[model samples]
Structure formats: C-alpha cells, structure tokens
Target: MTSSYGLTRLVLTDFRNYGSAQLTCDVRPVILTGPNGAGKTNILEAISFLSPGRGLRRAKLSEVTRNNEESKKPEKEQNSSLSWAWGIASTLSTPQGSWDIGTGLEIQEGKERRIVKIGGEILKSQTLLRDYVHVLWVTPQMDRLFQEGAATRRRFLDRLVYGLDSMHVTRVTRYEHYMRERSRLLKYGGADRHWFDALEARMSAEGVAISAARRQFIDHLLQAKAWTLGTFPQAELALAGQIESWLGAYSALETEEKFREVLKASRQQDRESGGVACGPHRSDFTVTYREKNRAAAFCSTGEQKALLISIVFAAARLQNLQGAGVPLMLLDEIVAHFDERRRAALFEEILSLKMQAWMTGTDIGLFTSFNNKVQYFRVENAMVHEKSVLIKM
Candidate 1:
C-alpha cells in the first residue's frame, strides 16, 4: 500500500529569513525554485525541526530565530525588543486522520527552549514527534559526507538509524551524556575509582545499546534488495570501532563487560588524550560500491553523489518495509547536479514511494519533468509564494 500521510498545511513565524509565511498544498512533491540566499533551505530546515535534535543545519536554538531589524536600531530609538522565538505549525494527513503538529522556540528564564504541541495541546518531549511522522533530508552540505572526518559519517549513520529506530536518539543522547561526564572526570585527574567505575558501567550499557542499534540498521541495509534500473550503484555498508569489532565474537552483555574493562584499562590513556579512549562515540561507518567493489571515498565526485542518493533510496525503502509511515523527504538543491534522465528517475522513485518530497533548486527547469504533478513555489526576498502557472516539460 502507498503511504497515506503527508503535510497539507505549513505555517512559519519568525523563522530564519521568513518573518511570516503559510504554504498550503496537496500531499505531493513540492518544488521550490529560488536563487541562492533566498531562504529556500530555511523552509526545509523548519520542517526538520519537527523531528527531535538540532534539525538539518545543527544550528543553535537561538540562531534559528530571525534577527530583529529593530535590534540594529539605536538602543534608545528601538521600538521593541526581538521576540527571540520562532514557530512552525503543520497539518499532517494520515490514513487514520489529520493532526495539527506545532513546534517552536519559547524563551523561558532568559533561555530559549523548544516546545512541541499536537492538536493544540502541549507535548512533554520532542520524542513524541516520532509517533506522528518521520522526516528525512539531504542538503548540499551532505555532499562531502564521504570525504569528511569519521565524526560526520557517524552522525550520518546515526540519522539513518534514528529514522528506523526512534529510541536510537534517546540511547545516543544518554550515551553521549555519560561519556562527557566520564571525560570531564578523566580530565580532572583526580577522579574517584568508585565514581569512575559507576560512570563506566553506565556508559558501557548505553554504549552497547547504541552500537547494537547501529549494527541492526547496517544489517538490515545490507540484506535489502538492490535498487533496480537506477544509475546509482548499491553501497556495501560496514561499521568500524572497538565496540563494533567485539560484537561478532561476543554477546552484547559480554561486550558490555569487556567494554567496561577496556575503559578501566585505558583510563590513563584517556586522561592523556583528554577524551574517551574508545567506544561507540568513536565509531565510523564505511561505504563501498557493491558492483565495483571500490570504497566510496575513492569513487569519482559524481559517482559519490550518485552512491549517496542510492543509499538514501535504499533507506527510504527499508523504512517503508519496516512499516514506518510515509516519510517527508527534503532534497535541498539535489536536482541541480542530476542530468535529465537521473532527475526523471528520482521523481519516479519519489512518486512510487508516495512521499511528500520538498525539493529546492535555483532553476525551475531542472524540475520540469514534475510539472503539473507537484506543487510549485517561488522563494524570493525571504518570502515564499505559490507559482501561478505550471510550466510543461
């Protein structure tokens, strides 16, 4: 069955470059065409905030609020202070029904806090968002994922896993928190043995959970059927890290115990390094072209881009099979790099998946293949307006 859920209404207030905007459209792909610095990506970033964490840009909470023009005025002449807040509300139509989901930043006690509301009632935590919708995005910045350091790749893998397993976020957050506390204690050089042991025990438990979740995702991806009739090549996924290395030879429990021992043994080294010596925190993900048997990093630039797209497609399919409802896809300037044939294929795949994809590009012609099939919008001067005419391909 095709997905029966998509965003029907979106409203942005004091968000990024847009002071106020509302977009209404059917649950189909949305093509946003605009020049650079026209706030195209800002729209996608707002949608990304619907899910938990730092959103697509990984920006600070304060950074998302639109800078007040009044703030620039002379201190005595300014009419009002900036609200220092932003809001996003959307109507999500699912097979079960429709619900209004809202998220925004509210200043509390001189600090900005993220708030979530469903159908006008406040939600206690952002994690509640996973039950209503799943969001996936690709940005121009991600083009360098393979070429970047291991930390970026790890984050990429975690995001993919988070889509499949919502609890992965909580586990990762807890693991990182414990690791930070442990690192702080190590750095101080006077950590108590008992307290350090307690911290390591907690870290081991959460670390194993994080590693297990990642491994499960990788295993699922590896066994998934390859994409057919696509120009992109399938990727061979692998995990590299101390915890991942032990999973093959030991049960999770055993590995946790071993990890605790390793932590204790490496305390001096960790102290010297000023960080956790080894754990899931240091894990890395490696991708290879299945057919060519070459590492993704070694692939040509265009080939690498294609490979990334292939993996995203594979991930989308996997989520579908796993019964995650239709995921909203945000493709930022993705069409700018693809040829006509590839662009057509990309649109077809999105249609087949029945996903509500938000695509951005400077040239509307790149999305001519989707004319009349998707909502068209023009983003300019920090404002988004629906295009009146649909240009035929």
Candidate 2:
C-alpha cells in the first residue's frame, strides 16, 4: 500500500526560534533528534501549519517569532515585524503537466497571510491549497487523547475527517459561524424566535452532515479492522451521543430534523451556558480493545500507544488505496517510551505501510533497525542537517 509524494521541500526564513534553516529529504522516513527546547518540535509545527488547522502547537502566528531579533543576525532591511516567507514545494509528474505546487505563509504584526500558487500563479480561493497537499500528525501532547474530555477527542476526529473529506472543513466552518451568530443572539437580552428558527435549521443540516461524515470515517476504520489488527491489537469503536443514537434509529433527513428540534429546545439551556450544550459538538469516540474487552483509556500505556499506532497505520493504508497520496506523517518522540520489541514492531509497521513518515527522538539508536535506504536528518539550534536515513543497509 505504498504511495509516493508529489511535493517535498520546506524553506524557512526569519521564522520563529529558527534563525534560518532549509530542510530537504528524499521523501523516505526521517528521524530528527535533539535535546528539549532545541527546536525539534518547532520544525514539526512549521509543517503542521502548512495544513488547514492551527499548527502542531496551535500557537498564534505572533507567538512563532523569536524574542531577540538582533540575536539571529538581522536580515538588514528584511522587516523585523514581517515574519518572512515559509513555503512547501511538491514535485509533480504527469504527461500533460510537470511542475511544483506551493503554499506560502507570511505574517505581519499579528495577522497571517496565506497565498496558494501553482507553478507561480496565485490562487483566488484558499481551498485550492488542499488539492496539492494533505498532512496528518500526532504530537506528544496527544498521548493522553483518550483520557481527555469528549471535546478534545472530537477535535482529533475532525482533523482525521478533514484529511479524508475536504468538504468536511467547509461544513464545520459554516456550522461554527452559525453557532457564533446564534450564541450572539442569545447573549442579547431579547431575541426573536424567528432568529433561532432560520439559523437553527442551517446549523442542524451542517451538524448532522458533520456527524455522518465522522461516522463514515469510523466505519471505514472498523471495516479495515481485520487487516489493522494483524499488526496491532484489535479494537472496536463506538460513537457516543444523540447523533449516534439518532443515526442508529432514523434516516439521514429524520436525524437532521431531530437534531434541529434538539437544538431548538436546548436554546434556553445554551443561553445559560453561553455555548451549545448538546449536539455533534459534544459527541465522543469510545474505543475498546476487543481482545482485552477494555476501554482504550484504561489500557496500559504501551497497549494504548500500540492502538494509536495501529489506527494511524490503517488510515495511511486506506488513504493509499483511495489515491489520497501517502499521508505525510509527523511523529514526535513516538518511540521514547516503547520497549525494544515494541519499537521494532512500530518500525516494521511503518515500513509495511510505506508512507513517508517523519519522526523525532533523542535516542540515535532508535532508528538502527531500519535499512540504510531510509533518509534521516538531525536538528540542532533550529537548524536541520541531513544524516544517513539508516546507518547500515
């Protein structure tokens, strides 16, 4: 199920803690190793920002700049306040077309400006950016995902769904706007029932669609379970909330209407809370290891890590089959806590999936089991250096 990348280059100038660095690799699995605060994670964050949502850290554009501008050797007149260009290039090969597709980010003061260009022509809609690139990542922060609140897991699900369904981003975006307006109306001392009526209908349509897409993704995940479990533990996933219950018993349109009515009735309570109290927004994903018959959250740490890795590998393989390109994986310190056997299994599974995975760890020995064919790099003081992907074949 291996897939090749159409794009591969990260050029950064005057960005964040990084003084100035250019990173290039052969699209093979890469491992970045460095001490904490040495800016290894920052590189991953840069790549994450290239995608739709907030970067890996989800920090504001302003927070990404360095503190002492003079320390990194000022760029003379490069505009200290203007965080300069950061872009990714993808090499495309086709009989009718052969060129690079790129997306760049520029920040001035506190606002971020994104420009999407193909072979140098600027695009009108940012949506055009997704056609060329799709990114999926996991950070150390996500290690406790199952133990977190439902909202946290919902966010994770939305990110995964976004990779498979580009339109899902638009649906969620429109629904969010509707929610904001509805909340504003509620915040006011008085509001017309008609106000809630129109907006609630729109919200209901989008919300139900959003939930349906999520369920579809989970279902695909389950359908792939037999193959997924061969490399890792077997797991069963259950959807928890009104949307799931409605989906179990009603048709799509009926579920949408039922969700609409629920939203209408919850307005009074929502007004009191200042946020929607019930809906797909409140839904959760319950994961159970079928063999162990126990919730993922309560499973041993090693078991949980294996489960997470298994799901990610499954999604990558699915993407390949769907011609979604190999999902560019950004993993940070993924094997830090794993024992040798698990570490070897993780490496083997990654190779089996054949996606271009980028990982970070402090242990140089972590990647020793890999073949010399894997491309590798080292990070220090925000600078990246190319190293042999594997020390020996």
Show the lowest summed lDDT stretch of 10 residues, model 1. 75-84
TM-score of 1: 0.92
Write candidate 1's Cα lDDT for 1-393 as tens digits.
335678888999888888889989878889898888999999999989888778999999889988978434355433333333789999988989999999998875566778999999998888778778778888888878898999888888887887789888888888888988888888866768999999999999999999999999989877877465257677889999999989988999999999999999998898888888889989889999889999999988777878888877788888888877557999998887878788888898988889899999998888877767788999998888999665854
- Clash pairs for candidate 2: 7-90, 374-389, 375-389, 376-389
Q: Which stretches of candidate 2 lie over 4 Å from their true place?
A: 1-3, 71-128, 189-192, 226-231, 389-393
- What TM-score against the true fold does each predicted structure earn? 0.92, 0.87
